[model samples]
Target: MKLTPLEIKQQTFEKGLRGYDVADVQAFLTLVSNEFEHLLNKNKELEHEIEKLTDRVKHYERVEEALHETLQTAKESVEQKMDGAKQEAKSTLQKAEMEADAIIKEANHQRQQIRQSILRLLDRREEIINGISSYLDNAKKSVNQFSKDDMGTFKLPKEEDLEESIDKVTSKSSYSRFELDEEDLEISSYEEEDSAFAPGSDRLDDILDEID
Candidate 1:
């Protein structure tokens, strides 16, 4: 039968002619019962302490697991962000390089156009200078030739006489812008064919060819 501390303390023994000593047995039983009760109480306290310690250990384990998961998630997020930043930097660099190249190309094209315009302006300036030089040379020749020709008296010639002289000289290759009307042709000259067909006439032809 199961025996509790109280049951052991209250147990009784049958009387006998040669049984163990009653006082000694009863005293020993009482002592054993008190010691058993103390041991049971101590065991119960130890069990409760073990249960509390186990709960504490389980809680710490859960915290450690959560911390590990959080650390891993943070690591992944940082890596992803780093990758995105690198890609963005690369794209931005490429765009900047393309823009710089385009600007350089445009600048080069503008420089080429400016250079061409300068060259064309220089050619036109040279052409104008040559034309002016030729005109001056022809004017010098015509003046020298007219000085050699025999001029009449210091008086001006009549309009009809001037017209007749101009008609005889202008029978060859013609010129523009030098068309002398009645008033403009009132210059005195010798009435001879050789005087009319002198260096002045040839110089005039040269001037007209240059103009043409």
Candidate 2:
């Protein structure tokens, strides 16, 4: 049967001849019951402490597990962000390269167009210069032939004829500013002044100088 501290203290024994002393035995039993009760209380307290310690250990284990999971999640997130950043950088670089190539291509095309325009301008300038030089040579030849004529007095060409010739020569050139008009010719009859027709006359020389 299960025996408690109270039961042990309350237990009774039958008396017999030459048995133990009653008072002494009763005293020893009381002491043993008290000691047993104290031991039981101490054991109960130790068990409570052990239970609390076990609960704390379990709580710590759960916390450690949660921390480990959090760290793992953070690591994965960082890696994913890094990968996204790398992809973005690569895309940006490719776009920039394409833009640079397009700009360079456009610049080269514009440069070529400018070069062609310059060449055309140079050719046009040469044509105008040649036309003006040819016109001046023809004018000089005509003037020399007229001076060598056998006429007694030097006769100037009619104003209308001179104007027509000038118009034809100036039409092929861009130097309109150099064109001469009738007002600038100052042509008149030389019959009154025979010296004007002389070989060493300054009048003819002055006309030729004005033409030049």
lDDT string, candidate 2, 1-212, tens digits: 76678987898888999988989888988999999999889999999999999999999999999999999999999999999999999999999999999999999999999999999978876765665566556556656755675874467889998899789887876677766776554343343244334343334454455445
Candidate 2, RMSD to the unseen true structure: 16.1
Candidate 1 weakest lDDT stretch, 10 residues: 187-196
What's model 1's lDDT at 75? 92
Best by TM-score: 2
Per-candidate TM equals 0.54, 0.56
Q: Write down the RMSD of all candidates, one decimal each.
A: 11.9, 16.1
Q: Write the per-residue lDDT of candidate 1 for residues 90-174, one digit (tens) a residue.
A: 9999999999999999999999999999999788768756766665676667567656636665568899999997887787565
Local error of candidate 1 at residue 173 (angstroms)? 45
The backbone clash count of each candidate, in order, is 0, 0
Indicate the residue-level lDDT of 153 in model 1.
56
Q: Candidate 2's error at 123, in angstroms?
A: 3.6
